[model samples]
Target: MRNLQHYTDDAFEFHKEVLKSKNTTKKDPSYKERIENMDDAIEGQFSAYNDNFVRNTLENIDSYGHTDDEKNDLLKLYSYKNSVIKNLKVKITTTAANRIINTCPNCTISEINSFDHYLPKDEFPEFVVNPQNLFPSCTICNGYKNYIWIEGGKRVFLNLYLDSLPAEQYLFVNLAITGDVITTTFYLQNNGDINNDIFEIIETHYNKLHLLERFSANINEVITSLENTIISFVGKLPLDEIKDSIIEKSNRDRIAFGHNYWKSILEIELANCVEYMNRFVTID
Candidate 1:
């Protein structure tokens, strides 16, 4: 779904300016006082169970709903919410590290860059300039989802912008064609130490988000059609001059693919192709 949007060059600068003025949430004094009271109540009530501990009140954040002056449960809830968000930052950063995008997908400016996590300033006070936790999106997608609780139990805004995701997640190279294509709906999968978990997440997303099944036919055909495109790209070259032509063709495609994760890989591939061409072909 996120892969559909192409990155506009120089989108980073615009976001830098926006980041300065966004996210203005703070803990209410009333909320803080209530939480302290809850902790005191829980400590007094659970004093007897302290040693034989059936369950720590601290662990009830996800299970606890809410109530006025319910300090103990509120304490746990706040703690849990903060912890989950921190862990979420780790996930976002890891995703950003694996992705490759040179421009912002949000605003259409080349000067801007970053895939911003849509968390509000109120939500994550300390994580303002978290680059890894950010995406290469323009102000559009970022401004759109700020601090909103999205569907499901998870928050609404995307942690990693779709463009800031690795192509390996949604795309692959057809060895035969050298074209980029979305993985087959049935074939979509995840690989990692948490492969099963990630796979399940992706599979659920594919269905819930209606991703692969709904993708355009051309997405997959990008990779499948590469061989022909490459040949077509080289067709008019003189027989003795064909070697340089092939190297150049690969370079162009490499850039095309590189805008996603393969951007760097494509650059490297272009260099290797050029080297190979020079070794075998001599210009007259």
Candidate 2:
């Protein structure tokens, strides 16, 4: 998983713009009171957020006599025609490369299709538009995560903008050969430099997202793609040369995509196996 830069927009100014735009729409009986409550919530959210703040805000919403329907209406402000939301989408989509497949830094297997409220908007309406609370994610990870990060008084997921991921390699793939077919088993290996809390967070993230199973499901495609490439090299190069070429490609992928990228790890491990090389060499 990778980290992203926090959005630089002034949070209060962003909230104000949404409110200003909403003022022009047809008003309801409780529109004025709803606007005032939203304004107060935005103002109160200027400080750092924590579990206590979330708990207090949820209680305050009830005390203010806001109905579920009223809160849902207020949540629409997050998607209102605002420059802040537009800019956030652009920044997230183009952050690390020309195109981001999945904007959720924790899982890279799928394409990004939605924004996940790091804290579910239903439960923490105050942060519905808080830039830090919005994470770009694939529909799958978003559904899997679904407001379940905090459990038993511990944060279970890694905050893409806040948590410091270990620089050393932790995710690894084990390669196994059965006759002509190859299979991969992905697992996490601890790096002693990383603290236990962060390690646990990664473990929880991997399990919650079902990353190992997801990656395994697609391993056949990866093997087929690699086999196609290796076949091209069969006659063009010697056995050792072909082996070196695959390893070089693997290293290049590792440099570009990170050590844990499925293809990178797969290629590196596949290159080292004598049976894999022999099988490729025997291909006509």
Candidate 3:
């Protein structure tokens, strides 16, 4: 997973903008005013999240229980997320979706087109429009992560904005070559360098998101791309030189993505696999 720059928009101001754009014809015309009156309370909840987030104790914050009518209104704010995103004045959500790295930070597998509420809006309605709580995500990871955040008093998902991903290698892939078929299996191990607590969370992250399975399912495409690269060098470079080129590419990707990036990790593994490298040497 990758770290992201957190949004700096003020919570109350953002809510006001969303509330202003909401269609108030169906509900109490004063509904907007009613919601606005809760500004202090909303800011308190925002502060609660900030404090607990810094302490890595977000689980300590309880879900706010509001009156049925009020809860409905707050939930509607989240529904207006698209409006919030599209509004030029409210660029916080849009800015997040347009980050330099365009992939979902949670999986780095797909393009991100939606925002995921780190704290599900249903549970934390007061934070419905809080940019700090919204993360840019692909629909797939967003659905897979749906409403599942913590278990056993530990965070099952990492807050990319708050949690600093480990620089050390933890995610690994083991390639099994059987005759002409190759199988890629991705797994996570602490690698003796990561903190035990951090690693536990990492394990939960992979399991909860089914990342290993997803990575394995998609790895064939990466392998095919690598094979195509090797095919181009078959007659032009020796085996060692070809392996070095693959390593160089992997290194570049690791810098562009991260150490645990699935593609880069697999590329390095393929580079070191003498048997796999030899397949390129004799390609027709």
CA RMSD per model (angstroms)? 13.5, 4.4, 2.8
Candidate 3 lDDT (Cα, whole model)?
Answer: 0.80
Tens digit of lDDT per residue, candidate 3, span 72-109?
87887765246775452234323444635557778888
Sliding window of 10 residues with minimal summed lDDT for model 3: 88-97
Among the numbered candidates, top lDDT falls to: 3
- Report the C-alpha displacement of residue 66, candidate 1, in angstroms: 18
Off by over 4 Å in 2: 18-33, 50-70, 79-86, 96-104
Clashing pairs in 2: none
Q: lDDT score, residue 222, model 3?
A: 90
Between prediction 1 and prediction 2, the one with superior TM-score is 2
**Considering every candidate listed, which one attains the maximal TM-score?**
3
Clashes of each: 31, 0, 0
Score every model by TM-score.
0.31, 0.82, 0.90
- Residue 194's lDDT within candidate 3 is 96
lDDT of each: 0.36, 0.70, 0.80
Residue by residue across 260-283, what tens digits does model 1's lDDT show?
A: 233222322333454423322333
